[model samples]
Target: MQEATETTHSTAPQLAAPAAESSVRRTVLLAFVIILVALLGVFASRFSVSPRGAASPALLVATQPALAITAALAAMIVSLLIALTLAKPINAVVSLFALGCAFAAYAMQTGTISDFVFLGANFKLAALETIAWSVFIALAAIITFRVGGPLVDVPAHNRDGTFTGEIIHKRALMSLLAAVLAIPVLIFTMIGASKGQAIGACAIAGVLTSVIGRMIAPRAQPILLFAMPALVIGLAQLALAFATTISPDIAFVNATLSPIRVPMPMDIATGSLIGVAIGLGWSKGLVKHEPPSMHDE
Candidate 1:
């Protein structure tokens, strides 16, 4: 009976792996469905004025009742899914969402005497702006989980005297890490897609950089940790641009490199901000584990 009990205890984790995978799979599926519905709803809304009968195209394009509403709802939904996965509350996610939106609005806001408000002239673009701006904020929140720190279930020295951070199987650790990383990307991708943007690649790259950086140099300085990936990306873009100038590959450049727009300050800023956030979050996590951190099951 003692032998049987010992065997069961050893095999418990192996059995739990399948259950955890199933839960993750379900969460991903649910998030996907929500995103699809959100996109369909946005397009279905009749916020854009019909171009055929409009007296002024600009005025027509500027008026957007549906888009604003859709964006708010989408933001909330996206934020909630992310929050749930990260083991954070709705309030935290909401704060991040608001910050992102504010940043976008500030960047887009004009200093013109007539139009001092951000995106004031083109309110119709609010949704796209929110989605784009929030990409970094969302990515930062996700990074806080992967290499950020451990979310311990109990104190280091429990009554039983078992340390929570005891070494586990390599496969189990990898699986946990993968699930923790994937959840944010999944939600971020869905949000980006809903807004007709491609910020998914940026998030993926940012997370990977954070993970690899931690493994290679766990004690690296926060600033360097954050800035290195962005620098590498910038250099890569520079190389690509040089290559394009020497080769007659306009088609390839336009198709693949156009969207990345490495020459643009905005793109560089976005990437760098994401990296900094990731590094900062990782450093914080390394310092200590606390409540509200993304729970990696």
Candidate 2:
């Protein structure tokens, strides 16, 4: 019996090593696929935008809305194909968000949002364009999830432990906490006044939020966790914008509040989607495990 036990123990590491290596490889490949799709989407979307000129905000003024919309559609189609081929439908949805992020980051770098607000440009039209992008991307995500196979249920023990009776409320609270925790990180990273900062900030915020969020709410859906932060940030920005309309003094205060810099909606969405995927991949096996199931089938 002693020898039999020793033999089993000796083989266990050998079996586990290959599985661990395989998991790492899969994660790296997934990250690469997402990054590649995002780059492709950015390239496709930018092809339609006219080159920047000596005039300030010329890029925004020169861009034709119809052409830009067409570019966004083309980018989405390309990203969807690549994501479906390389990953799953859920990943395809993430890729679409990443594409939007890429576009928004570019816009931010070129001072599009600030120009819209301060330059007497048609801010409403710009806002409408953003809304259109969000609606279409969200619809795509919903459709993909619906068409994809149903999500596998986590074992009940893994989902809810000693506090089974209050698990619903606990999950909701933890999810909210996770979103709140992520807000500062997003704001800090995005407050920088440098070009191309939004993309990096979003990526950082997303990964950090997911890692911390998973620890607090292991049973929460990753997508839900990701979305909560973006939703919170987006709503906060909208509220601030509305406040600016109530009084010019409020607008001045908003402009001076460096810490409360407004990021494009797509920036938040992109960060949450891609960051969560990366975080979940990198933090696999690091989270605390629930007790082994007592009711074995």
Candidate 3:
């Protein structure tokens, strides 16, 4: 019995090591991915805004991009820490907030998908931007999968051939809420696009979304892993624009429009109320669905 027990113990680690290795690889890959997303934000800001460190007229893109990237990176890190650690309940609250901010930013900056309310975008991607988003989505899948941990669904042969409902895992849901902590980063994008104190407000919106989703169904984890860099750089750049009064005076026909706005931070009372709701009201909220397979979109 002693010898048999020893053999089983030895084999157990061997079984576990592969998953551990995969986890390490995922972490490294995600770190690199974080850097890449930040760089993209930097690049995006170079074209639209006249940043402080903007070098000579010709090579200005390189200098201006870094600050925007840095702010995004900061938001990404903090939000993740909050979600993965003590404040997991805030996920759902932030998710809705982020979802709203994303569409709002898109609306404020690029113009609506259509003049008519519910249709496709009037302005599609600039080819390169579309490609960049595609790459981001792929990276997001890797991040989401890593956070969710190992999956061991029933085998196809043992399972019915016909489709059945998803097999939900509690650990997966917890991991997802942890991951969705990166909420503030996306709100920055809304701030970047807005015309008033929308940046801080949008940043606050991010916090609110996490708070709300924490109340509702729990914002999906994938929302945090990718959306962070997307919004933060925009937020940073917008804040900078708002600070120095450097934004373009976009004209509608003749008169110039008002300058861009940063979002406001939520009041302490509101933040507390939302946080309490997220903490108490929807403790049982679950991530909506399992992420798509790694094979493709």
Query: For each candidate, what TM-score against the reference?
Result: 0.32, 0.60, 0.32
Model 1 residue-pair collision total? 1
* Descending-lDDT candidate ranking: 2, 1, 3
Compare the candidates by TM-score and give the number of the best one: 2
Residue 269's C-alpha lDDT in candidate 3? 15
Q: What digit string (tens of lDDT, one per residue) describes model 2 on residues 1-297? A: 999999999999999999899778757755766577657655654543433431223223435746655655676666655554433524433444444444443344344335334544433333333344445544544444334322332223344333323233455346546656556776666665343565567667667766787676554444345455555555555455555454323443465633333444445555556666567666656676465435320
Alpha carbon deviation, residue 166, candidate 1 (Å):
22
Which stretches in model 1 have alpha-carbon errors above 4 Å? 1-78, 81-204, 212-259, 262-297
Q: What is the lDDT of residue 49 in candidate 2?
A: 47
Give per-candidate clash totals: 1, 0, 28
Q: Of models 1 and 3, which has the larger TM-score?
A: 3
Tell me how far the alpha carbon of residue 257 in candidate 2 is from the true structure, in angstroms, after superposition.
4.9
RMSD score of candidate 1 (Å): 13.8
lDDT of each: 0.35, 0.51, 0.31
Decreasing TM-score order of the candidates = 2, 3, 1
Q: What is the lDDT of residue 51 in candidate 3?
A: 29
Alpha-carbon lDDT of model 1: 0.35
Cα shift from native, residue 220, model 2 (Å): 2.9
